[model samples]
Target: MNIYLTRHGQTEWNTQGRLQGWQNSPLTEKGRKDAKLLGERLSKIPLDIIYSSSSQRALDTAKIIKGNRNIETIIDDNLREINMGPWEGRILEEIEKENPVEYFNYWNAPHLYVPLKGGEYFEDVQKRSVAVIDKIIKEGKYKNVLVVTHGITLKNILNYYDNKAMENLWDTPFIQGTSLSKIEVRDEGIHVPFFGDTSHLE
Candidate 1:
C-alpha cells in the first residue's frame, strides 16, 4: 500500500502564529491556492480513497485535492489535531510568556511536557493517530491512500512510521503546510521514500 500524508494548508491562525488545536480558522487565500496546486500534481496519480481530519481546514484541503476525482473521502475524528484545550486559538508568544516552562517543554522536550486542563498528551495523540492508520492498513483494499491532517497530528503519525523516540519527535524536516510525505508498505516491510516534500507548491 502507498500512503500519502499531507498537513492541511496554511490557515489564518497559521499566519498569525496562533495555536489551532481543535479550534479552527478559515483557510487563507494562499492555503486554497496551495491545495489546488497539489491537486494538479496528484491529478495523474490513482488514489483509491482519502481520509481527512474532521477539521474544516483539513476537510477543505482534502476536497480540493480530490478535485473531480470520484474517490470516496471519509472524515475521521481520530485524525483531528491534538486537543490543545485552553491553549486552543491562543497566540504562541503569549503562551510562552505566561507558561514558559511548559511551553518550552512542548517544543524542546515533548516527552516531558504535560498538558494543561483539557489538553492532550503527545502520547495520546500518537496512539489515536496511529490507530486510524492501522485501521486503514487492516482494511487492505486501498493501493493508494491520501491522508489530510493537522501539523501536530501528522508529526505524530510520521513519528510512528519512523519509529523514533518521543524525545526526537521534533526532528528535522519540518512538516510544512500542504507538504507531502510518502510511505510504502509491502509484504517485506515498510519504507519511507520521502517526507515533508513541497515541490508541488513550487
Candidate 2:
C-alpha cells in the first residue's frame, strides 16, 4: 500500500494567516483555480481512493481533483486540522507578533503547553492522526491512497514518521496549492515521507 499526502488549496484564512482549526471555510478564487490545475494533473494519474478532511476546503479540493473520476472521496473527520480554540479565525501573526511569550511557549514546549479555551493539544491531534492512518493500513482495500488534509495534520503525520518534535515538525516546508508528498509504506511497516513535491504545480 502507498500513501500520497496533499494539503488543500488556499483559503481566506490562509491569506489572512488565521488559525482555521475546526472552523469551516471554502477555497478562495485562486484556490479553486489551483484545484482545477490539480485536477488536471491528477486526472492522468491512477488513484484508487481519495480521503480528505471534512472541512470544506479539503473536501472541495478532493472533489476538484476527483472530478469526473467519481472516485470515492471519504470525508474522514480524523483528517481534519487541529482545533485551535480561541485562536481559530485569528491571524497567526497577530498572535505571534503580539502574544510573543505564549506563542513562543507553545512553539517550543507543546508537550507542556496547554490548549487555549476550546483549543486542542498537539497530543490530541497526534493521536487521532495515528488512528486514521492505522485504519487505512488495516483496510488494505487499495494500492494507492490519496490524503487531502491540513498543514498541521500533515506535519504531525510526518513527525510521527520522523520521530521529531512539534516545533521541528512545523519547520518542515509544505507549499500551497496541489502539494504532493510521497511516503513509502511497506507491507508490514511504518510510513516514511519523502517530503512535498510541487513539481506538478510547477
At residue 64, candidate 2 shows an lDDT of 85
Report the C-alpha lDDT of model 2 over 1-202, residue by residue, as the tens digit: 8788888988987887777889966789988877787778777768899989999889988888788886888888989998888877887788888667667766676666677678888888988987887788878888888899887788788788777877676577754666877666785676665676676666
Q: How far out, in Å, is residue 53 in model 2?
A: 0.8
Reference-based TM-score of each model: 0.98, 0.89
Candidate 1 TM-score over all chains jointly: 0.98
Q: In model 2, state the lDDT of residue 160.
A: 82
Q: Cα lDDT of model 1 overall?
A: 0.91
Give the per-residue Cα lDDT of candidate 2 at 28.
93
Candidate 1 displacement at residue 142 in angstroms = 0.5
RMSD of each candidate relative to the true structure: 0.8, 2.0
- With candidate 1 superimposed using the best TM-score fit, by how many Å does residue 17's alpha carbon deviate from the native? 0.8
- Stretches off by above 4 angstroms in model 2 are none
- Encode model 1's per-residue lDDT on 1-202: one tens digit a residue: 9999999999999999999999999999999999998889888789999999999999999999899889899999999999988898999999999989889999999999998999999999999999999988888889999999988888888888878888988985789888999878899877678888999887
